[model samples]
Target: MSEKILFVFEGEKTEHVIARNFISHYIQKENKTVIKISFCGEIYQLYKKMSEDDFGIEFVDLFPLLQERDENLKKYKRDDFSQIYLFFDYDPHATNASNSILNELLDVFCQETEKGKLFVSYPMVESIRCYNGIEDNFMDLLINIDEVAYFKQTVNSYAHKKYNNVPQWTINIWSEVIDLHCRKANLIVHSKNDFPEREVPQDLILTKQIEHENKSNNVIVISAFPLMLLSHYGEKTASILQNLA
Candidate 1:
């Protein structure tokens, strides 16, 4: 039987796009469908995009607060679901937005169904950095990223220095991470919209909360094991997804 799973996150529409692809790839099951729900704005558009694919998912825009409530006790119970998954980043936002979301999930779960399980994937930046062989002290790795003028140059440099060539998946992940980081830098350097106070020094985040602060640019770290489990072991991933669903 198919299960209903909820994925809540604090990113824009693109995050959902990547998540759907990731979940579809990870589950490796075409028949056992999942319902992808989000709280991000413009749910209708996401629903349209989700419908276009044969990923076997029904996407919805749920209220962001659902994560905090218990699935069993709520007035509108989602008892069909075996589990609920919450994906968010512990980025350097003063608002404690991630914790607030977590609290909501806790409130619901404790009140509704003790049987329900919650999975939290966080610090996406560290996840990507780890995949790309970037050190935890990523400030040091910045030199390498900045020096890679071209892929060929990177490869040549890798050969000269005997640095391992990054895997294709790692490269893709790094591309996203780097793009996010650069964009965040631009945001700080250019505008003062979401970030009002002076941007915290990168050195502080890089040295102490490198894993924690990656979310500042939407680059929260995630466990590569989840990705690997979904991609390499198709049959097992299917079983896991089925159970979770």
Candidate 2:
């Protein structure tokens, strides 16, 4: 059997679109690996689903009884996947319930860092679009506008609208968009490794390490997903991000 890689995302919109497109392109070229993508609404929902499916306990029930439950669940080890990634964003405006949910999810992911990896985009998933080395400029353009509003107006809406217009928006078109915007800013888009990192929890294992100049700069940290693809597939991943305009 081929090596199975699973990606679970936080939503069905942009995250799903990017993950699905990247996985589809990746598997077509890489016959040795099988990729599967799933969306479970949010980070907490993903934790809840994984816990119940893999350990037979809800997130709430797992914490207090973790010692006993972990011992029992060891016998039911889930070793089918070669790699499992959870894609989420660190939204500053998240609800109280969502914040609490992410705290629990972070706790569980920290414990299973070897088996489960979390790829969190700071601010929002739109950060991935901003990863083309022009983030500072792009963010500056959004200074007067909210990030979500800018994303919806620029990246998200543009993709969907273009998709509708053509009946099929190929990966080449996606590449064109990236190249056009990145080149316009005189930016040389690099891979995930080149991006700067913001501080996360000390206990959390970030797959890729990056540094920030200061506390106030808007930084995009992609710990897995696209970075994993880039590491394994190289230029193919970059091709998907953008090509020369």
Candidate 3:
């Protein structure tokens, strides 16, 4: 049987393009069939909808949302996917943004075998390119609420040229980037400076981000897609990225 994987994303453009390339380059070889859908809104909106009185704690029926937003997903049942993943931005600047809501959503959806696994990009998705070099301190790239609106341009201007555009990135580029982001995530979760050896729970990353934001009113820049790779592919993802194109 073909293993089906579902990606529910926040944006219709960049997030979709980046993730498709990463999965196509890295995971599809394992015979996983991929399906992509866009939530078409910020994370807070999904929380409000999910927390509505009718939805309750059962809070897990994304196929309906996917079918409503994308014509292609309508025919597929929830059971069709062997694994499901969600990518959304931690747009704390958003009007409805609340740490509590985000925390609840993260806790609820923490398992891929169950509800789904979620990875959050700080401020926005452009964070994937927020790295400048292998040796540079990526944690230095933090954004306050004021900078959130202009972060895409900021990353475009300051990120390493090799990682600036989706079209220009080869499988080689994908592996290199996957290596960078996963290592950066390890720094956030475990205070480690090496590649992750185990899963870093999404809720823990959020807790770390919240602590930083509370102290400085700025979130450390990070991307969702690359971190998602760590969970989906596990520790081998770091080592495989070291060896792959």
- TM-score winner: 3
Q: lDDT, candidate 2, residue 68?
A: 39
Instruction: Identify the leading candidate in terms of lDDT.
Output: 3
Put down candidate 3 lDDT per residue, 1-245, tens digits, no spaces. Answer: 87998888898998877776777777788888998888898888887767664858456576686688778788798899888898999988788889998898888878787788788988788888777875566755678878888887888888888778876789887777777777777887887878887777788888889888889888888888878888877868766786776
Q: Which pairs clash in model 3?
A: 172-245
Give candidate 2's whole-model lDDT.
0.43
Cα RMSD of all models vs. native, in order, equals 14.9, 8.7, 1.6
Task: Give all TM-scores, in the order shown.
Answer: 0.38, 0.50, 0.94
Query: lDDT score of model 1?
Result: 0.36
Better of 2 and 3 by TM-score: 3
Residues 1-245, candidate 1: write the lDDT tens digits: 66555454445453455455455644435444455554442222223333455642222223223433323224344565544454443333323344433433433322112332233233431233332333333322332222222333333433222122223233234334333343333233343222212322222233333433443433333322243233233335334444443
Q: Per-model C-alpha lDDT, please? A: 0.36, 0.43, 0.81
The order by descending TM-score is 3, 2, 1
Q: Candidate 2 at residue 96, lDDT?
A: 28
Per candidate, the number of residue pairs that clash is 19, 0, 1
Question: TM-score of predicted model 2?
Answer: 0.50
